[model samples]
Target chain A: SQQGEEDPQALSIQEGENATMNCSYKTSINNLQWYRQNSGRGLVHLILIRSNEREKHSGRLRVTLDTSKKSSSLLITASRAADTASYFCATDETGGAQKLVFGQGTRLTINP
Target chain B: NAGVTQTPKFRVLKTGQSMTLLCAQDMNHEYMYWYRQDPGMGLRLIHYSVGEGTTAKGEVPDGYNVSRLKKQNFLLGLESAAPSQTSVYFCASRRPGTGRFYNEQFFGPGTRLTVL
Candidate 1:
């Protein structure tokens, strides 16, 4: 079963606009990581936010985690056509077994 | 360096047929995993190996089997193909990070399997 669920199953936006996606998980996590998948390709690691931390940034991507709510959000500023892809959030449970549970994912499209 | 690679990018199998998908990693990661992706289902774990010669079931282990005979290779096998087993399969490997935490996993290109 998927431990996380993403909101806005799909999103479409024009270039230069900001895009935001949210993910909610059921159990405590050691860390939450975001990944991106291009059409018909494997996923690429984007960014990882540790449980102890609340927010993280990399380039045009920003991620905020709220453990109290068991949810996280990914923000992409100034979206571009190339930024269009499926985004997924994976959680590593807070226990001995280090396995990642993934969410359904949000498909984002950036129109040029 | 070809972080991770999967064999047979695409395949079609008849119901009741069997096949094995191969996955390899060159990062010398100690952890390897197999996952299946279906439309609207993101991805679900099939099995995982923490080290060579050791394997464990994941969230979705039924209808699938896995083997990790080598540290850098993981294989997933379907004994009896079914229409419901048709999906995109992904293989990933990861190494432990500082403390007991783990680093991000590297995924293969994925293999598309179809059963009719």
Candidate 2:
């Protein structure tokens, strides 16, 4: 079974707007990571938040993790048309050579 | 520095034909993984390697076989191709670290395989 499940399988917004995506997991994970994938390309690492950390920021990207709820959310402020891609959340149950289970992903479209 | 790379950007195979997919990393990462991406299934791990000459089965490993003979290269092999195995294959590598933290993995461009 997949460890992570992302809500709002698809989303659309205008450029410069904000986009929020949620991810829920079924198990206790050591850490969770977010990735972005453009069509016909490999995934690019966005940010990673550990279970001990509540929130993290990287430029326009913000990530929040609630270990108690086994869930995480990624927020993109001032979204750009280039940000249009499929966003995925992956959770690692343990550390050191751990396997990452990814969610079905949320397809976000940023219209210019 | 060519973080991760997979050979044969695209391939088409006939049923019962066998082929091998190669993944190489230049970052000296100890953990290597192979995954297949399908529409609704996301990315499912086929096999993974913790270190050289070590391989382990993952969530969906029934039809896939993997080997990591060298420290920097991981190979995924299909003895007999099946139509069901058609999907985009991705290879990733992560450097080892301690504590309860997630390590960012570098991914290759991916290989699109079609079995007819």
> What stretches of model 1 exceed 4 Å from their correct place?
B98-100
Top lDDT model? 1
lDDT of 1 by residue, B39-103 (tens): 99999999999999999999889999899999999999999999999999999999966322668
Q: Considering every candidate listed, which one attains the maximal DockQ? A: 2
Listed per prediction, chain B TM-scores read: 0.95, 0.96
Model 2 segments more than 4 A misplaced: A95-97
**Per-residue lDDT tens digits of candidate 2, residues B9-44?**
999999999999999999999999999999988899
Error of 2 at A94 (Å): 3.8
Quote model 1's TM-score for chain B. Answer: 0.95
Q: How would the docking of model 2 be graded?
A: medium
Work out the iRMS of candidate 2.
1.4
Give the alpha-carbon lDDT of every model: 0.94, 0.92
Against the native complex, each candidate's DockQ, computed on alpha carbons, is 0.66, 0.73
CAPRI level of candidate 1: medium
Residue-wise lDDT of candidate 1 within A64-99, one digit each (tens)? 999999999999999999999999999988863768
